[model samples]
Target: MSRRPPARRRPARRPRRPRQQQEHLVGLLLAAAAALWLMATVVHWLLAHWWILLAAAVIAVLGGIGWWQQRVQRAQWEHAQARALRYGLPQLDALSHRQFEYTVRDLMYRDGCTDAVQVGGQGDLGADVKATDPHGRRWVIQCKHRRHGEQGAAVGTPELQVLNGTGRPVHKADVVVMVTNGRITQPGRDFARQQRLHLVDRQLLASWAAGSRPLWELLPALPPPRKPSRLS
Candidate 1:
C-alpha cells in the first residue's frame, strides 16, 4: 500500500470575545477624552449611537417589570387557590372579576407560556389575556367567570364570534381561547368547532386548577381526526 501524504495542518482560530465585553470595550474607546474618566459617558455614547443597545435596555426594563408583576400575581393566585381548595375547586366562583382574570393569567404562565399578560376590562375588545408560547404563537383568551349555579348561564356563539373577530389581525393571535366557569351552549360549541376556537369549560378549568391535568394534555390546537376513507 502507498504511504498516505501528511495531512495539512489547520490554522488556529482566535478566541472570540463575548458580545457584551466587545460592546463595552468599543463604547469605552469611543468616549471623548474629557469624559473618558466617567463610565456613565461611555454608556451614554453607546445608547446614543447604538439604537439596538437602547432598545435592549428598554426591553430589559420591561421584562423586569413583567417578571415582578408575574411574581406578585402568582402569589395572589396561590393565595386564592388555597382558599378555593378549602371548599373545593367550586369555591373559584367566589373570586372577583379582576381576581378571576389574574387567576387565568397565572394558569397560562404555568402552562408553559413564555409570557401571559392581562388586558381585560373596558375596551379589551373581548380578549382578557394575551399569551405567547415558546414557539412564538400568540393566543388571546377570554375568561367568563360565570357562577356555577342552577340559573345555568351558558356562554354562547355571540361571545365566540366577538373573540374570533378581534383575536386575529387586531391582537395578532394565532389562536383564541374562551374559558368559562359555566356550560357552553350547543350553538357555541358548533360555532367554535367551525371556527377552530378553543373552548375550555367548567370541568376542564377545575381539573387544570386542581393540578390534575397539565395544559399540554388539554391543548386545543390539535387537529380534528380525519374521517375514514370510504374506499377502505
Candidate 2:
C-alpha cells in the first residue's frame, strides 16, 4: 500500500509561437525593405532635380540668416527698452542730497568702479563718493544737485578749486570727478581742464543713464601721449 502512493503530476509547459516569431521577422524585413526603397526613390528624385535641391538649400540658408537677424534686432530692441526704463535722469533732481550722492555711487559701481561708496556728510572732506576704477585708479567724486529754479549761480570755478584741494591732498585720489545734475560754469570747465579733473554734467549723466554712452567714453581727453583711463 505505501509503494502505491499516487505519483505527482508536473505542470504543462506553454508552447512557443514559432509562426508568430517568423511572422515578426518577416514584418521587420518588409519594413526595412520599404524604408530602403523609399530612400532610393528620394535619392533618385533629388539627383534628377539637383537644381531644385540647390534652390532649396539656398532658400534654407537665407531663411536662417533672416531668422538670426530678426533675433538680433529683437534683442537690441529689448535692451533699449530695458535701458530706457532702468534710470530716469530727470528724476534725480527730486531726490535729497544724500539720495543723489547714493545714486552717484550706484552709477560709479555700474561703470566698473569697485568699492563705490557714498561718504557724503557734513565733514566728508569734499568727497561725496569714493571708488577705484578697473585700472586701480582711485577716484574721489563730488555730487552737486540743483533744482530747476534755484537762485544760486551754477557750480563755478571756486567749486573746482575746493574739490582739487581735497581730491589729491586730503583723499589721495588719482582721479577727481565732479558730477552735477545742473550746469558747470565755463570757468569751472576751464579750471577742471587745467587740473585734469573729470566733470560729468547734466547731459552727459543723462546719456550715461540712457545707455547711449559709457562714463569712460565721456571723460575729457588728456594731454598728448597720455592714454585714456579705462574702466576696470
Candidate 3:
C-alpha cells in the first residue's frame, strides 16, 4: 500500500490584534462622549443663568464709566491749578468784596484744597470759603476785604466772635480762619488766640500769597492729619 502523503499541517492560527484595536476605539468613544456631555452641561447652565452674566456686564460697564469720569475731573483740576493767577497786595486791594472772596477760594486751591469754593454771599452765615485741606481738616474761612491795605478798618472781635460761633456748629469746621488784607485789632487778636481761631492778617497774607508753603504749615496748633482708611 502506498504511504499516504502527510497532510500539510494547518498554518498556525494568527494572533488577533483586532481585539486590542476595538478596545482602544471603545475607550476613545467613551472619552468623546464624556467631553460632549460636559460641554452640553456648561451650555445649559449658562443659558439658565443669563441674567447673572448680563448683570456682570452692566456693572463692568458702569465701573469703567465712573473711572473715566474721575480721571477727567482730576485732569481738569490739575489744569486749573497750573493756570491759577498769583496775586499781590495791590491786586488784592483793587478787588471788590465778591472778588476778594473768590481770590481766597483760589488761594485755597493753590494750597491743595481741592474742594475750595466761595460761598460768601447772603445767607452764608460768615463762612466765605469752605474747603477741606489735604490734611483732612475742614476749613471755614471768612474774608475781610480792605480797599487800602493796613490803613483800612481793622478786623475786630465782633467778626471773630461770629466766625467762632458758627465755624464749628453751623459750618462744621475743624479750623476757622479770618483772612484780611488789613490789621486785626489787639482785642481781636487776643480773642482769636484764646478761641484757637487762626488769623491771616496783612503781613501773614503777604507771606502766604508769595510763597509755595501750604497754609497749614504757617499756622500752629492744628489738629493732626487724618490717617487714610484701609479700603481707600
Clashes in predicted model 2: 1
The clash tally of candidate 3 reads 0
Instruction: State the TM-score for model 3.
Output: 0.66
**Candidate 2 structure quality by residue, lDDT tens digits, 1-232:** 3677799899997777987899999999999999999999999999999999999999999999999999999977755554444356658777788888998877777666658899999998889999877666688999888866133348889889989989999999877899887888998999998889989888877877657454666786622222355322
Instruction: Give the poorly placed runs of model 3, Cα more than 4 Å off.
Output: 1-80, 228-232
Q: Pick the candidate with the highest TM-score.
A: 3
* lDDT tens readout by residue for model 1, 119-166: 999999999999875555677999888765324589999989999899
Rate residue 127 of model 1 by lDDT. Answer: 91
lDDT of 3 by residue, 100-131 (tens): 99988888888778799999989999999999
- Candidate 2 stretches with Cα past 4 Å from truth are 1-85, 149-152, 222-232
Off by over 4 Å in 1: 1-88, 149-151, 223-232
Candidate 1, residue 96: the lDDT equals 71
After TM-score superposition, what is the CA distance of residue 131 in candidate 1 from its true location, in Å?
A: 0.9
For every model shown, what is its TM-score relative to the native structure? Answer: 0.57, 0.57, 0.66
